[model samples]
Target: MKFTTATPTGAGPAAQFTGNVWFDVIVAGQEPSRVRVNTVRFAPGAHTFWHRHVLGQTLHVVAGVALVGTRDGVVFEAHPGETVVCPPGEEHWHGATPELFMQHLAIWETDGSDAPETTWLEEVTEEQYSAARTRSA
Candidate 1:
């Protein structure tokens, strides 16, 4: 068994996220192992852009409240200890609700040999975000 050194928390890029979001890489497997895990923290009202993983993604909420939205305008509210899964190629976005900060561990893997791990698309429009907030209220 071996212990891996911890890396500093990094800010999520503006191109990929909005508001204030940060993440720490928990594990990024070496060659032959495509697994990736990250502990992400989002400030109230912060969120990721529309994106999808090649092999799919799983999110385990760790604190506060999480809001996950799909392309079809369905937003799921998940609290601490809950897990949400997005199937491969299904565009989605996740982050904190407007009232509280949130944290979640995102786990995913690459599809197969020569496959990209993630595909990032456009940002979530204001209309879509507002709709989600209305639904949550």
Candidate 2:
């Protein structure tokens, strides 16, 4: 058995996210493995731009409330211990609620090709984020 080395926290780039966001890479698998995992933290009101994964993505919330928005104007409110899945090629964005800090484990897999695992689109507008949301039951 081997222990993995820890990586320093990285600030989510402005090109891909808005507000204050940070992440720690938990696993960036080697050649034989294509999985990737990260623990992401969002300050109040911080969130990622609209993006889609080639092989879909899963998010497991760890703290505060998380708001995940989709192209259909549906924002899903997820709390701690809740998990959300975004199917492959579905455009979506996720972040903390305006009043709270949030953190989640972002998990996805690469397609094993040279292509990027995720394609980022436009930033989520305030109107889109402020839309009414449905809480996860």
Candidate 3:
């Protein structure tokens, strides 16, 4: 049994994220494994742009509050210890609430091919963000 000591943190691309976000690769599975895991941290109000996974995605909130929104204007809320899932090819975005920093374990799979696993779309506009918060409130 081989154990990894630690995995380095990766900076989320600015083109795909707003504010500040960081990710640590917890697991990078290969061939037989087929699973990928990332421990992602977002500063208050920081969030990822609209995107969708080829094989779906799951998020387990580790601390603070998480806000996940879909293309249809539904912003699902999750507090610490809560988990959320986005079905395959369902465009969505996730991040920390405006008031608190947040961390979550993002679990997904590698399509195991050359094609990209995620397709990122436009950034969340201020109006859209505000509306979501208001609706959630």
Candidate 4:
């Protein structure tokens, strides 16, 4: 067994997020592994740009309310301890609701080669952000 050093929290890139967001890399897999994990924190009104994973992605809410939106105008509201999964190549975006801060562990795997695990598209516009609504479970 081996202990991995911890990396300090870093700001999420402006190209990928709007408002205040931070992330700490928990696991950046090495050879023999293709998985990657990050603990992400989003301030109220903060969110990611539209993006998709090459393999897929899973998000486990750690605190506050999480609003996850998709291309088809569906938004999923996940509370603490809830897990949201995005299938491979599905365009989606997720972040904190406008009223509170939120945190989640973002989990996904690399394609295991040179291809990026995620492809980021345009940012979610004001109309999109305000249109978030809970879907029937």
Candidate 5:
């Protein structure tokens, strides 16, 4: 029953994100636990670069609207209280819409080894970001 220490909010680096973004670590489990959780805030038009998790990732929208896109140009729209999952190794990107600020809890696990848990790729182009989105029911 140990309480986790508070961690400082961090700016999303330009190398991995576009526009303005910030994140606060919620849970970063130690050995024997691989779970990692963070509350991420994105400014309007902010988004992450193309990336994939080694063991998958989960996102729970907390405010505003979220737009998640895949390699196939399909963007899924998620609103507050909705949850979305990206299966292991499925390349994807997520962020706030152009007109709204957004916040979501980003959850994922670290592979038990030294390898990177997320592989970041190229930034999402404007065409990709502006592509039409399919609303989540």
Candidate 6:
């Protein structure tokens, strides 16, 4: 196998993320392969807006702690080496804790058609974020 060309790290769209967040595309398969992988880094207190995947998504924590929350107010706490999965069409958000930076590998698949693979929803409200922060492990 040959090495793939490198691409620059890119910041998440301001419309979909809060604070400073960046990501590197690790792999984006071509036709006959729907796989996509990204290495995402989140600054302390930074996070993604609520969104859902058409084919589902998986996250493998690489460093620090990751907080993943659902519309129902459930927050799943994941630390380095842990893996988290979100089923197709489940609205959710994920990011680092207020005290630490975090990184995770996001893995997902695009639906094999022209339709978008993700549907981004509203931003995470400050109230919801605070509520999640107060949650006990």
Model 4 lowest lDDT segment of ten = 128-137
* TM-score: model 5 vs. ground truth: 0.98
Q: Rate the local accuracy (lDDT) of all candidates.
A: 0.88, 0.96, 0.87, 0.93, 0.97, 0.89
Model 2 CA deviation exceeding 4 Å by range = none
Q: Which should have the higher lDDT, number 2 or number 3?
A: 2
Sorted on lDDT, highest at the top, how do the candidates line up?
A: 5, 2, 4, 6, 1, 3
Stretches off by above 4 angstroms in model 1 are 112-114, 132-137
For residues 31-68, write the lDDT of model 3, one tens digit per residue. Answer: 68979999999999999999999999999999988888
lDDT of candidate 1 over 41-107, digit per residue (tens): 9999999999999889999999998988888887888889989889988999998888899999999
Clashing residue pair totals per candidate (backbone < 3 A)? 0, 0, 0, 0, 0, 0
- Residue lDDT tens for model 4, 10-66: 999999999999999999987788889999999999999999999999999999999
Q: Of the candidates numbered 4 and 6, which has the greater lDDT value?
A: 4
Taking every candidate in turn, the Cα RMSD to the unseen true structure, in Å, is: 2.4, 0.8, 2.1, 1.0, 0.9, 1.8
lDDT of 6 by residue, 1-137 (tens): 66988789999999999889999999987778899999999999999999999989999999999989888887777989889889999999999889999999999999888899999999999877766443333
Error of 4 at 58 (Å): 0.1
Candidate 5 global CA lDDT score? 0.97
Candidate 3 vs 6: which has more lDDT:
6
